[model samples]
Target chain A: EPEVTQTPSHQVTQMGQEVILRCVPISNHLYFYWYRQILGQKVEFLVSFYNNEISEKSEIFDDQFSVERPDGSNFTLKIRSTKLEDSAMYFCASSSDSVTEAFFGQGTRLTVV
Target chain B: GIQVEQSPPDLILQEGANSTLRCNFSDSVNNLQWFHQNPWGQLINLFYIPSGTKQNGRLSATTVATERYSLLYISSSQTTDSGVYFCAVHTGGGNKLTFGTGTQLKVEL
Candidate 1:
């Protein structure tokens, strides 16, 4: 079955550094999203992208975060100046439409020191 | 914003036992999904039952949209079924999913 794939299964970055997490959604999927889960916490939505632009974002998705479908196939989430609290598992998901079931990637474990 | 609450918070079952997990949403939803988070932390999609009933193998799910609650039933469970089950919902015109607290299950011999 076709699946969403994320790059760098794990990443460790220093405080104040920048990190980019990349994802390749299913070939025909159009809506893309970024979500994060802190250890032992529930998953929280960060942002949703459609038509090559962000459709909606949560309060947690502040100035430090940005998402882009830099290419036709790749969607990326960039965090500027990472903080210790930013450490979490980042998941990328995509769906064929807004109300369809979205598929998630394996996720990237971001660790900030 | 909508609120999601999952029941029992945690469960333990013996191999071959059966169990039920529940998810309750505060408002109407356009979509509802059940995901199993494995030990490796991958979210495995189990079902997308916004309403009605759907069964796949030993697992089945039923969502009563009007009641605003969904139930996931696991029959003859196995050790591999040990993990956290999360129910997420899509509300209004938003594309982002609001996830439930999750039900952690541990099936043992």
Candidate 2:
């Protein structure tokens, strides 16, 4: 089965540094999303992308975060000046449409020191 | 915004035992999905029961959209089934999924 693939299974960055997490969604998927889960916390939605633009974002998705579909197959999330609280598992997901079931990637573990 | 509540935050079952997990949502949803986060933290998709019943192998799920609740049944559980089960729902027309608190199940041999 086709799946969403994320790069760098784990990453460790210093505070105030920048990090980019990349994902390649399923080829035929039309909607892409970025979500994060703090240790022992709920999975939180960060942003959703469609048509090469951000369709919606949550309050947690502030100025420090940005997402881009740099190419037809690559979707990326960039966090500028990482904070200690930013340490979490970031998941990338995609779906055929906005309302369909989305498939998730294995997730990228981001650790900020 | 919608609220999702999962019952019995934790459960312990012996191998070959049966279990039922429940999820309750605060509002109507356009999509309802059940996912299992394994010990290694991989979110595995189990079922996408929005308003009906679907069974796969030893697992089955039923969602009553009007009632705003869904149930996941695991029959003859195995140690491999040990994981945290989460029910996620998308309300309104948004693409974001709001996840429930999760039910942690540990099936021991």
Candidate 3:
């Protein structure tokens, strides 16, 4: 079965540095999303992208965060300056449409120090 | 926004036992899904039963949209089934899912 794929399974970055997490959603998927889970916490939604624009975003997705679909296949989340609290597992998911089952990638573990 | 609650926050079972997990939502939903987060922290898609019933091998799920709840049944549980099971729902016709507090299940030999 086709699955969502994320790059840089794990990343370590300085507190003031930038990081971009990349994902390649299923080829035919039309909606994409980004979610994060802090250690021992529930998964939290960050943002949703469709038609090269953001559909919705949470408070956690503030000024520092931005998502881009630079190409037809790549979806990326960039954080301008990492904070210690930013350490978490970031997941990328995609669905065929707005109301279908979304498939998740293995996730990229972001560690800020 | 919607609230999702999962029952029996934690469960322990011996191999070959049977178990059931339940999820309740506060409002009508457009999508309901069950996911398993393994020890390695990978979210595995188990079921996508927005309504009605779906069965895959020893696992089955039923969602009653009107009642606003869903149930997941695991028969002949194995050690491999040990993981945190989560129920998530999307309400008001959007793609963002609100996740319920998970039920952590541990199956021992």
Steric clashes per prediction: 0, 0, 0
Q: Write down the worst ten-residue block by lDDT for model 1 chain A.
A: A65-74
Off by over 4 Å in 3: none
DockQ of predicted model 2: 0.86
Give each candidate's interface RMSD in Å: 0.4, 0.6, 0.7
Residue lDDT tens for model 2, A9-109: 99999999999999999999999999999998878899999998999999999999999988889999999999999999999999999889999999999
Q: For residues B54-104, could you state the per-residue lDDT of candidate 3 as single tens digits? A: 999999999999999999999999999999999999987567988999999
Angstrom error at residue B22, model 2: 0.3
- lDDT (10s digit) by residue, model 1, range A7-92: 99999999999999999999999899999999999999999999989999999999999999988999999999999999999999
Model 2 vs. true fold: TM: 0.99
Candidates ranked by TM-score, best first? 1, 2, 3
Local distance difference test, each candidate:
0.97, 0.95, 0.95
- lDDT for B40 in candidate 1 is 96
DockQ of each two-chain model: 0.96, 0.86, 0.87
List the pairs of residues colliding in candidate 2: none
Query: In terms of docking quality, how is candidate 2 classified?
Result: high
TM-score (chain B) of candidate 3: 0.97
lDDT, candidate 1, B38-73, per-residue tens? 999999999999999999999999999999999999
True contacts kept of each: 0.95, 0.75, 0.82
